[model samples]
Target chain A: MVRVTGVADETPTVRTIRFEDPGMAAALPGQFAMVWVPGGGELPMSVMAGDPGGAAFTVRRHGPASTALYGVDRGDLIGVRGPYGNTFDVREGRLLLAGGGTGMVPMMRLAMRVADPSRVVILMGARTAPEVIFERAAAALGEVVISTDDGSRGEEGTAVDAARRLLGSGRFSAAYVCGPEPMMAGIVAEARSRGVFVQASIERPMKCGVGICGSCCMGDRLVCSDGTVFDGDRLAATGEFGAIYRDKAGIARRY
Target chain B: MGLATRVAGIDLAGPAMLASGILGISMDVFRRLLDSGAGAVVSKSLSAEPREGYPNPTMAEAAGGWLNAVGLSNPGAPNFANMMRGAPGVPVVVSLVGSDPDEFVSMARLFEGLEVPAFELNLSCPHVEKVGLEVGDDPELVSRIVRSLKGAGVRVIAKVGLGSSDYLGTVRAAEDAGADAVTAINTVRAMSIDVHSGRPVLSNGFGGLSGPPIRPIAVRCVREITSRHEIPVIGCGGVSCWEDAAEFLLAGASAVQVGTAAGGNPGIFAEINSGISSYMERRGYSEISEVRRAA
Candidate 1:
């Protein structure tokens, strides 16, 4: 069981919950844990770098499990298992990270892990001003550019739009992304046009965080094992990457 | 010869299959496993309606195996049947679970156009209520389910497990009702508790255990079922290596299914197939049937 040591509001509905877990801390930037709320259900949360030798998960207050998790504060205990799935493969030189809402968690963590922090450029996306989270934390890691859909933040468009504009202006060694499927697909396409190496962390309805359950499947890849983070070339090859995904019921749904 | 063999009326390129609940349901995954040398693949058990299954802590590793209470989450028959559209000859066995005989037969018929080799009647799932072992425990219900499916012209394989009632009786009922084959043993009923938390590890409190720990029990059940009835047996549980596969075959299982182990090694099918071929050559056995005869 992991005890919450601290909680901080990232946005109106999002909170960053901190806990000390050696395995989770050691996990790669894109991996996640299956956090089991005491009496509630378990949900997968992306692993984040925490202060004083611990790990953290950023939760957006929605759904029963996430709401229960969002309300947890200091000393609250929750069952956590994993550090499961693949991670972001760090590359040298300039790196571009783009994400929105809670999807920014892994991108922010990846920014911190890069060898040359100053070379990391992040395009943080949100719907409005208050929803743009961790701007200072991201800036401290490198360069942070915020994009809000309503034009209340840094840029007056989606991260994909901001990224597309930036792609022509500069040469990034690689691009890392996380967000809604369409958003990631857009950034990946932009990155591909510029011949940039890209990696994207995908979110699937996961039952078993382990590889056995087919709930997290995308195309032929079991997201829980093959990757929560997949390379640009790999993603581009799988038609299901941005097109079709399975819900908890195992019914295919288009993004 | 090669690792090729036959289970009931179905032809298997190898004797190792991808067990249900382990990356099952996708015809794409079945094709991948088939390409990787698996004999066949079983889809996760499906009911009349889709099930979301139990929440997390559904699986816990303990006591030399995995304890799981996934609650048989699956897309209902219609959705899965649609997924199988135009993808024939994948050699997948559809596994069905429900509260009664009519439910099983109705589900089997949904895949009529898919050429699904058989429906593996899941009468042994250990965690769920009303169905699974609860229904399997009643010999009358077992007969009715198998008979109904057979009457609908659906080839069936009865998967038996250790429940409160005699497993032998379950096998007998399935055989008498015209089951094509029997998969001896589902996961063994088991649980694990966290000492510090003073609570059960699995959400269901208790779940079914699979992996190295249950191999002997599964082997014993297979030997017993094969000896008592004419039903061919497909042994499941704790089959991680070639020797385990060979052991099951020698004990009279026509095919072996791997679950827990394959989660880590997707190449297990190819590994087991090669190992079995080596075992047959080393033992001077030309046929899989010859190995059973030697036993």
Candidate 2:
């Protein structure tokens, strides 16, 4: 169990719940925690670690689990079953992070901790203006770009638009991504086309939080243990990226 | 000699089968496990209808290994059948769980066209209610379920665990009903309480314990079952290393199933297979059958 150190409402619908966990300090971006929200339940969440933020999971308030987690405040205790899942292979180079929805959480952490903040470019996507989260915080870390589906923010189209602009311009060492399958798929393709190495974090309905239950299956890979962060090569080999995902019942569905 | 073995009349390349509900349940993962060195693999128990399953905290690290009460969450037999379409011939066993003989038999029939080697009747799930241990405790029900599946020409293996009633009777019922073989144990009924919050660790209040802690009890069950009946036995529960797998064989099991322990190191199958080969050399045994109980 860990203590909730602070809570900040990133947006109207999104909130960042912070915790004081020394163990999580070592967790790289895209790694996760099976955070048990006291009386509510446990869910796999990407742990966002930064210097000032310490460690936290950003909740978007969608389901019963997220709703309960979004309602948490300071000093409350919750159980953590991670630092689970693999981490991103961020090296010293010009890094690109493209994320949409709650996927931006980990990218923000990447921006904050990358080897060279000056060489980092972070792109965040949301549906509308108010839905745009962590804009103020992300700007503090590196070069920030925002895109919204309805054109309510910085750029109209999607994060793919901003990503295309950056990757098309010059050489990028690697790209780290998270968010909706289609969007991540687009960004991954764009990054790869430009000869930039790419890694993507994926979400699946997980039961045991540990890799054993076989719940968080994404195509052929167990998203919990094998990776929430998968390289472009791994994703391309399975042909599951931008194609299919599994639900809680182990039912395969097209993304 | 090679690490080749057979259980329930099904030829398995190795003797170690991946226990139900490890890593994700997909044809892709199954092929990976087989290629990785597992003899065969068991799917997580599927039911008549899709179950959403229990909330979080469904599993916890306990004294021996993992304690999990996943509430039998599955994609249902129909969906699983869809996934199994055009499946390659691997020694994959589909585990079925339900309330009655009809549910079990009907679910088994859904895989009729698939190359599924066998159906493992999950009569031993310790945490669920009205099924699993509940069904096993009722010898008549066990007999009917196994008999109905066997009557359909579908190979059946009844998995049994310690329950309120005599678990041996459950195995006897399966044997008398013509079950192909029996997996001798399931996770032991167990729980962990969080004194900090004064609540149970698992959301289900209690769960089945699997891993090293249950190895001794599992070996004892396999020994007792083999001693009493001529039916083949597949020992499961708490088998982490080849020594544990060999111990099960020495206790009279024809094969072994590894759970909890394999979650972290899937390569354990190859290690155990290698260990078993060297063990055969050390004992001068030629096959899995020769690694039997000592007087």
Candidate 3:
């Protein structure tokens, strides 16, 4: 059992919890871990920090596990297994990281790894101002840009729209995006059109983080093992990501 | 040793195999099963065309186990054939589902010159649209599909569901249609409502139920099918432990398929296999075949 050592409300619906597991805190940024809330269920969450002994996860209260997680105290015990999947490569160049909703978790970690602060840009979006998380934290990392659907704060329109405006004026070597499926899909498309190397983080309901359950399979790729981070070109090839996912019976449905 | 169990000349290390539907879809996961001691790994059901499957909330837990409507989402036979090429040394069983006989024949032919160990005709997927056992329920259709794959040279196992009005009749139909064996008890059609929103748990409204809840029904169906037919019966449904597997064997199943139980515990195959070996050892039985119909 891992002990929770820190908790911060990133948004009304999302919170970043830091664990006191020495092994987890040392996990790399792009890798994710599975948090089991005992009776609730096990869920895969990306590492929001590069510290192995002090791992963190930004969770949105959307399901049972997350809901129960929100009730956890700083000293509460939670089960964690991993540092699984691949991480973002923060090589030298003009890097642009776009995050929307809860997708901002990993991007915040990526922002810290930018070798050159001036070359890094973090673009974020949300439905409203209250939903925006880690604005100050992200600004401390690099140039932070925020967008909201309701124009409650920052620029009006979606995160991709804001990214387009940023791209119009600057030349970026690579782009990393994470958000809802549609948001990531749109960002990946726009980034590809601009000839930027794009790696996007994907989410799926996963049971076994080791790729045995097959619940998180996206086309030829297994999201848990092959990726939660895939380049634009690779993401476009998997027919399931932007499209529909089927049930056990062969019916076309959404994720 | 009573009788050696061999399907199409392929020696099964044991009589228990991890069925196709449950986490058997991914090559990595399939490898894990082999590492965990599954005699064979059945691939997830594949179709003639690629499918996206159903939406969110496709699986839900019930009183005894899980219900899922994962809509046989696959990468299509063409792509699946390529994936199968990289599989481990264990026998690989390819499961195929289709709406009509032509579709089944088309999928089977795709693997025709390939090295697949066996083919399981999935006539019993409960979540698809007008395909699977929904159409397989027609005895004539089952006959036609099986007949079309007669000389495929690969061992053919006709996988069917329970709760059908004419369960024995359907098994006979598949045998008459040229099935080399049969896998009993796919998921049972079930549904659940979200008490708060008053909505169905699955996007498909209803899903096939598996786990301990369906074990008795599976045993009953296997008994009926194996007693009446000359073909080997592969008992499936809610097999969680060696005792459950042993019960199916006593009921006359030559082999058994582990599904929902595997999802909860990946090491279950090894545990069950070990348990069976120990039970057989104590009883002075040297082979798994000796336990079949031991009752």
Give the number of the best model, judged by DockQ: 2
**What are the runs in model 3 whose C-alpha is more than 4 Å off?**
A1-132, A135-213, A217-255, B1-4, B7-10, B86-90
In model 1, residue pairs whose N, Cα or C atoms come closer than 3 Å (at least 3 residues apart or on different chains), thus clashing, are none
Model 1: per-residue Cα lDDT over A143-233, one tens digit each: 8888989998788988899999878776788899999888999999999888888999988887777777778877678888888999988
Per-residue CA lDDT of model 2 for A1-255, tens digit only, reads 888888988888899898878877668778888877767877888888875536888899988888989998899888887788877887677888888989988888777667466888888888889988877788777788888888988899888888898898885888899998899899899988887899999887777666688776665677878888898888887877898877777677787
Model 1, residue A131: C-alpha shift (Å):
1.4
* CAPRI classification of candidate 2: medium
Q: Which stretches of candidate 1 lie over 4 Å from their true place?
A: A50-52
> On residues B166-193, what C-alpha lDDT tens digit does candidate 3 reach at each position?
7677788888877888899899888987
Q: Model 3, B279: alpha-carbon shift in Å?
A: 0.5
| Winner by lDDT | 1
CA lDDT, candidate 1, residue B290: 83
Ordered by TM-score, highest first, the candidates read: 1, 2, 3
Q: Write the per-residue lDDT of candidate 1 for residues B1-295, one digit (tens) a residue.
A: 7678888998888899889888875677778878988888889998899987887768877777888998888888888888888466676788999989878877887887786888998899999999999989999999998988899987899999999999999999999989999998899998887766678878789899999999999999999987878889999989999899989988989999999888857899999988888888998988888878778
User: Which TM-score values does chain B get in all models?
Assistant: 0.98, 0.97, 0.94
